[model samples]
Target chain A: MSVSVSANEVADAPQEARERTILGLTADAWLRILMPLAIGVIALGGWEWAVRANGVPSYILPGPIEVGQTLVRDWHTLSISLWITLQITFAALFVAALLGLALAVLFAQSRVIELSLFPYAVILQVTPVVAIAPLIIIWVDDIRIALLICAWIVAFFPILSNTTLGLNSADHNLQDLFRLYRASRWQVLMRLRLPTAMPYFLGGLRISGGLALIGAIVAEFVAGTGGRASGLAYRILESGYNLQIPRMFAALVLISLTGIAIFLAMTLVSHLALRHWHESAMKERR
Target chain B: MLAGVKAGPPVVTLDGVVKRYANGTLAVQGVDMAIGQGDFVSLLGPSGCGKSTVLRMVAGLIAPTAGRIGMAAGGEATGDVGFVFQEPTLMPWSNTLKNVMLPLRLAGMNRGEAADRAAAALAEVGLKGFEKAYPRALSGGMKMRVSIARALVTKPRLLLMDEPFAALDEITRHRLNNDLLTLWQAERFTAIFVTHSVFESVYLSRRIVVMAARPGRVVEDIEVNAAYPRGEVFRTSAEYAAHCREVSDALHRAMGE
Candidate 1:
């Protein structure tokens, strides 16, 4: 009757996982790292070859080498802007995690509360962040605060949705055992539900990491922040307007690096949390 | 409460304990039973019968819809009541020793004392070297052993199990039946086991209480004259076979066979 043990963790897992991965193998230990790196390398290589062969203008599609030069030349400016973007992303992420977890716990505990507000949450998730960013910007006045609200809106749902399901979807037999032993509700959550939810929570965080980055950048673009406190997005737009193609490519590199850093950091955390107990993070081949 | 005490003052009693669901499903009706001190009893029935329901009620996990159930008042429930579920049901996130220590933690025993108690229990269950291994890392039989260790860790006066070894292979089940008998002999604790297998009932229990489905109630109460620490040779004996067959046939009759 229950679909899969993994359903509570990865709701959007591919319906049919592909077997092919450049060879006849189901998995590779470093595939998560290797696969992404490989894709990035191949993409950059193609971009370089396309530019050279067609003799296109550098302003349109700056090659990786030119982008690297621009990055080195404007290191201080890029670093400051990147730091601002990073600050907003992490702040939003922390708030979203706290709020999402609290909401999940609330919903998990009471059916009435869950039933009353779950539809509103669904509506919030479905509504676009871009549509709400302008409103949040107008109300907040502070550019940083506006960007945080936008990013939180984009990132909060996955945590809440995944965590609520994880809390509810604990092994029923294990739950019965805990009840039989008269374990308190707090004990049940601390010992059972939280551990079970870690994988799901991490999976949610992985998706939300990308969303949060996109949200921060888009929020910057929409709000148009001041000179001294501008983010990577502002620099990106500034470069584009001035036709600084290599510098634009440099900004693009920073954004991609941020996304990759967020992804890798989350993956590392996921491995650390579940490495000992779960099959998902198993290292030794059986 | 008076009804529970009315059963001639048993160590534990279930008097007219009816369990009817809101869906109008009467799983158990007026089930009266008493377990004396230090007795090994098995509630045997088919899949749908209320053997497990009775076990759960005894373990205080589920309350009956009607009538009274009582244990010796304030008699150390946290420390003196150990329950083994159908499957291992070990906290998969915890190691073997930690799983065993859970009851001790609930009992408010200190960590060092709990660890010592858990160690002793694991040794009793023949899992001395596996204290650090997680449940998922263990085989089916080993996990069940850990479950048994966890149940026995508190040195509870009463232990309740609901088809604990039902998921195990035949050899594992037989081996564990022997191991369980040895543990019971060593511990001298009261145990109430729920099982659908008549063979397991005959093999393990000093008394077998057979029940029927659709208003679950006892249809037969028979005693096995087996001694403590029973072994594999007991299974091959004519007397054991006769008892097993009788219990099997009684089970068949209880199911309206």
Candidate 2:
């Protein structure tokens, strides 16, 4: 009887183990998603309760519900501002990527150019965009161009430095192999150096994406332009001046969401490009 | 002591070849070697013996400081040579097919022909279905196979390998060694292999050039009289053992010198 029982248990063991693994995987995945959501809900609930219990005025401390309601109510005006902010951010990011890549390639090709110019790039990065925006606006005479310059300066350095490092980091042996093949200078740059620099470029791009948004917002705050072309930062400022704290909170949420969206998009692009080869994007295998 | 098994006209000839680095180190000195066409030769030595330096000089990667190194076909500047480094040295961003295709592509061969030649080379290295796989997805042995495919894709006149299998495990190394010999026989390319392994040198080369360090120079040369298609039978046979013992003793004496 004991033998029969043990045999039956053995017969059932694989099926039981397989089912448990399937169940465990889903459970782990769900926990990963739901845990953060639960914390957010609890924190919002606590915030709402505190506001109500303390009887804080809407202009002073709008509750989460009021902010959401104001987000919906002020969607028309707020969205236009959001769009304007996005335009500046993306434009700056695009220009930064183009110029940064070109400059990196140039720097990789010549040590003299890099040694002469890299310090200026560093100086531009170190100087606060806020401190320079006023002078740029005054000198440029166009608020948009001035804002772009500010954002570009803020977003350019990482891509330049990262890509330069990556280009220089090609395997010494592989370089020798290329030399053995009598590869041309252009071929070496395109086939070896550029591909080697891709992961580092993408990493810098992710960081630059967030900085671009921050730059645009800060530039708008400094510009203080108060028209239809105003950005989310200006809306926040306007709402603050008008004591519309809920609307101000709504605009702040939009900016944060935009920043999050840009980061996620960059991360997705990096994953798609590098998933096959790069360690950073590859999935862990058992 | 330079007894080489002549196969044909000399493919590469090194006469009093010397290499002194910028930091005042004499890496190789007064090395004279004449590798016959289609011959398999191993530069066998201990570490710091500048075996790699000799190989690099042959490949024209670094110039000899004091002597003449000649290629029969002017192979150095014309991309008529292939080299395998100690590492697999594959571009991680590229797949096996692309990596193997690099030399042909760099030579301005059109895409389709390069692809076909690369695929054939990959098949020759026993990596037929792994063409689409990246280097990261490959095992160390497989990566080395891909590296060999890349080196041979150009169908160069001379193939130079510097300790290419030293990083692999003994089993993989033995397997690759056998595969390499087969490739060399089939391709009929003059091969110059650099290694510190006496057993490996005996197993792979028709001739072994033993070298010593501290102003590195050749100390002894031994000819292996074994026949072609050397395998496990040859590896365990008394003749192979004797050749290995002879090479090992030569290496020991070279080290002492």
**Model 1 docking category:** incorrect
DockQ top scorer: 2
lDDT of 1 by residue, A1-286 (tens): 0011122212321233345455554457367668998998999899889988898888888778788989999989999999999999988888888888889889988999999998888898899887888899999977799999999888889988988888887888788777766788888888888878878887888888888888899998888786967899999889889999899889888999999899999889888988767778875443
DockQ of predicted model 2? 0.24
Candidate 2 residue spans exceeding 4 A from truth = A1-29, B1-6
**Model 2 CA lDDT for position B185:** 75
Best-performing candidate as measured by TM-score: 2
The 10-residue segment of model 2 chain B with minimum total lDDT is B1-10
Fraction of true interface contacts that also occur in model 1:
0.24
Q: What is the lDDT for B229 in model 1? A: 53
Error of 1 at B215 (Å): 2.8
Q: What stretches of model 1 exceed 4 Å from their correct place?
A: A1-43, A284-286, B1-9, B73-76
